[model samples]
Target chain A: MSILLNKDSRIIVQGFTGSAGSFHAGKCIEYGSQIVGGVTPGRGGTTHLDRPVFNTVEEAVKKTAANVSLIFVPAPAAADSVMEAGKAGISLIICITEGIPVLDMAKAKQFLKTHAPQARLIGPNCPGVITPDECKAGIMPGYIHKKGPIGLVSRSGTLTYEAVHQLSQKGLGQSTVVGIGGDPIPGSSFVDILDLFERDPQTEAIVMIGEIGGSAEEDAAAFYKARMKKPLFIFIAGKSAPPGRRMGHAGAIVEGSAGTHASKIEALKSAGATVIENLSEIGSTVARNFKPVVA
Target chain B: MKLLEYEGKEIFRSLKVPLPEFGGVIDKPAQINSILKRLKKGPWVLKAQVLAGGRGKAGGVKLAKTPAEARAFAKAMIGMKMATHQTHGQTLKVEQVLVEQGVKIEKEFYFSVAIDRKIGSPVVIASSQGGVEIETLAAEHPEQIIKKPLDPVFGLLPFAARALAFELGVPAGHIASFSQVATTLVKLFIDKDMSLLEVNPLVLTPKGFVALDAKIVTDDNALFRHTDFSKRVDIEASPAEREAKKHDISYVGLDGNIGCMVNGAGLAMGTMDTIALAGGSPANFLDVGGAANQERVERAFKIILKDPKVKTILVNIFGGIVRCDMIAEGILAVLKKMKLQVPLVVRLEGTNSEKGREILDRSGTRLITASSLWEAAQKSVAATGGKI
Candidate 1:
């Protein structure tokens, strides 16, 4: 009943031979992700973690029938990897590489919108997504996640873990956790995942995390206030972060048109979602919002 | 990052944008005095060259009537630290101050084209109310701001530029000039690989349109293409920021005592948030950026240790793309290399995490291992004697 990924989803690893790619792919496999194969140019015929590798993503997809691709390429070529995956008909692509050029993403987004509108991409610099207790994608750890009804989505990875661990400690498990990536431009938005979470019957409530960048939260706020039927607990990080500096996330900047922590917090609060300013408060907030089930 | 008024003027001049006449960058106070003496055009503007905004309000910009006064102003600014809305008032090299003729503003207007997250395109925002805070304008008089998203393929069409210009109450005759500037701005944005090009108070002079102030921030990730533009980027950034760039850690310094380290930026910020929630301030936001190899981790640790204010070190690695044992090796490396006796709290969650904990447990580094972020923050705060 979770969204995006489950046991049946076939995954492909882009840049599978590189240090980050090979390492995370191995971990994803260990976490029960159906990693069909991998793609690393010039490393064709080589097997990593006993998965067959191909020179191109198109060739890998053709042979392995992989539907989703998680990329770990470095910044410079990261855009091309996403584009290649999109062109190869990979329905869901998650890019875990950070520091991708904004212009590159601008063009990539443009190309994605036009060429493959159905091809969903996650990040060029993001933590990816995890459908807890079933499959893990990107760079998130699998041990901390447990499957339940609460859907967790965030822009920060470690903060996601912090929140998840807290909820897990409180006996509140998650249905899915998606890191939309903290890049200035990401593949999916809060609303995109919210729609999925709303449809998943197992997900009774949601925990959404946002940072100070872009008006995505405001847009999400408007959507939630107008039509969101589920109980949503939210946290917006970087409330005290100074303006202009990129902080840790490529998208976490408080500058002109972006990053007024007050604005994001106020907007989310107005949107009817309980806003938790501190990471430690997310679990308790969600626990209070969601009624306990009696056996 | 913000370019100083003079540096902004340089970018403006390169774009063939009209501005008050200015000469080259001059460092020595005597050079500024000579330049002031040679100009002899009544009172001139002494603008400091820095990478921060709101310099005018910070007294970074001053008008001097005499060459001696200009020299005094230059001298005062040379070794002086100036803080602005965008900076911490760190002292710059005072390489050269621009001596330029001051413009009498008949009208002030705001014009900028930045990437709009909502529209997912570069949006041109224009307002007739210039020189005033755009946020205030947006808040109080929302109608004055005109936003038009530019297509990445075709860019800002002349019609869209004209529309924004017309909405700014630009005269019919000046619309052509403003449109040209707007089109050129789009070109400059694409060519220079800039994320933002702001000209607040694009004043209406008796002569024509002149950019009184310019704020241009190029996309750092696009620096590989804009090699020449990269050369002009402010090299006087904080030592930790500069060092982080070398090791690929996206570290930003803060005024706190706990030196925090995390593998992802969101996590790093969350750790900072958790520390603050626990009543401890984080000294820096260091994201080792998924590279938890010993070399990168040691480099990050060294950079964190450079901050004399950091009383304790908090290392939280989720170990997604990076293994935890490798992180352990890095902590040991930092412990051995710097011999840091500061209180250390380490939290590892992910692949080979137990091995990572084992390495730290046996390293003889006397580091605290927290099972969770809560315990880690408490340990870090306690290590700082609970003040931070």
Candidate 2:
């Protein structure tokens, strides 16, 4: 079974009337995810894509029993959508919108801590998650995936896709792939996803793709070293990146000796992780390190 | 985006944080008279308005005893290129000089309010050891520095700021003002969506604690909320990089020869790493964004070609959900129109990628196609006369 999503997940899209929301929600529906209903503020009585629409998240939740909320709101109003979803008791919220003010996100996270502690938020600036063959909740390509054993988590969107393409080529599929996002303060952490992956019965091994930012990777290493028995193959981006240069839109910056690529690699290696130094070898290294899982 | 010292001080002044009296910002040597009229001073500090740190030790800052001295300093600094350790090796060109009245300091202390990534909140840091050597001080004596993590929702407490002020060894007379500066700065950090707000050598003069210098980096993601600073330019970017920004492309210039045009940021960084692994250096980091069409393709090529060091261009586009044939046709269409100068190596992956590969093969335009990253990187490196 996948950790956060599966066949039973009833998903609803926020900002459903908008182009981004409708497009991705349609893609998810195309991949067989249950697009139960949606919420788009002013257009309450109207219906789009053969789904009922509600003005508020509470009414949508009550009407459709949507357990998973996928947010595609714009940056300025995105955090409000997150808080509203949490307030409506959406257990799993996957936000696909990027560039929400960090302070807004941080405050929303704090609100969720007391308001709906049970809600697990995936990202506010990330490509969502997908449990291949069963459900595709995010914007990830549905074709490259096949039902298998690897549980993947990453901070990047297309980089996760790149890793999946490599794994798929090797005839190794995944249990669930979670994109935790690349924001300075994301909704979920590596440790949280790692905990879920460790407990999931379907996940045999895990692959984590971290980059030059934050202490998330190192924190994961420190927390999961001795406890995790499954083979963990990891790859970090930005080894060739210069210090003080931000590599991307998200929090991919190498600062001093703290969040450098080399330091992250060293930390993960010391924690008994099989670190893939070469980008092209992520799949091959995983194949060599673990007992093969047929696709 | 990083703010220059003068710009940061402008914010600090607006927030009512005590700062050294601003003489003037001089674009030319003749503008020193503006400082003399406003400051009415004999001694002034002439500082190059640059984003680099360690400017004091790098000769970017100097003390001017007279108007003639300030004019001379301004003349020498206005168009000067100066480098510090923070600049990584390249020099930053000084376009303006900030001439401020020099104040006598009883003591110096470091104060800053910045986002703490690990805690996922704002943190206030202070140290009695200040000045340009604060980095060295932190490296040598970590205990001298004190930190207080704050919740951005509730903001920093006055008592907490007082404690930080006290611990940083501010005298009793200046504690009130110091705490005021600390609180205001924290509020400014939250309100302005700043990533970092540093007041180096927040000096204690005879009257009170005065901010001798200021540095700020506003969050680019939150720039939409603040329209004034939205048009941010990376002071360290090369000409090609600045042009790429105007074209809405993410490109960072590097000291390499193989120009890399990749699909994603993470993949772009990874591509650069792989290129380095293949015994080839990447000329720049270019993420052509998710949807790469004819216009973006032409724009990306133009930016990459602007870099004279680029010997080969490696285009790695990973198609997700969107079919690659359309993107491939767009790339081919763009490629056909351009008077190409360098070897172009392309790798297209994802749905309908095989058809896209066929299109590239049939086009007969000079191109090298690879199915994998390794093959593409190696081919690109070989095109640049590198052996792997």
**Best-fitting candidate, scored by TM-score:** 2
lDDT string for model 2 (A1-295, tens) is: 8899999999999999898889888999999999998899999989999999999999999999989999989998999999999999999999988878888887888889989998999986787899999999888888888789999999988889989989988878899999999889889999999999999988999999999978999998987786787788899999888888888656899766678888888989999999998878888888777775444
Superposed by TM-score, candidate 1 places the C-alpha of residue B150 at a distance from the truth, in angstroms, of: 0.9
Model 2 score (lDDT):
0.87
**lDDT per residue (tens digit) for residues B75-115 in model 1:** 88765677765564454455556678777777888988788
lDDT of each: 0.80, 0.87
Best by lDDT: 2
User: Tens-digit lDDT track for model 1 on A1-295?
Assistant: 7888888889999888898888888889888899998988998998888999999999998998888999988888988888888888889999988778876787787788888777988876667888886788877777777778898888887777778877876888888898888878778888888888988888889899888878888888888888788898988887657666677676888875556778888888988888887676677878877873420
Looking at model 2 chain B, report the run of 10 residues with the lowest lDDT sum: B230-239
Please state every model's RMSD to the true fold in angstroms: 3.2, 1.9
Clashing pairs in 1: A97-A125, B26-B96, B82-B89, B83-B89, B280-B388
Cand. 1 TM to true fold: 0.90
TM-score of chain B of each: 0.90, 0.95
Give the 10-residue window scoring lowest on summed lDDT in candidate 1 chain B.
Answer: B87-96
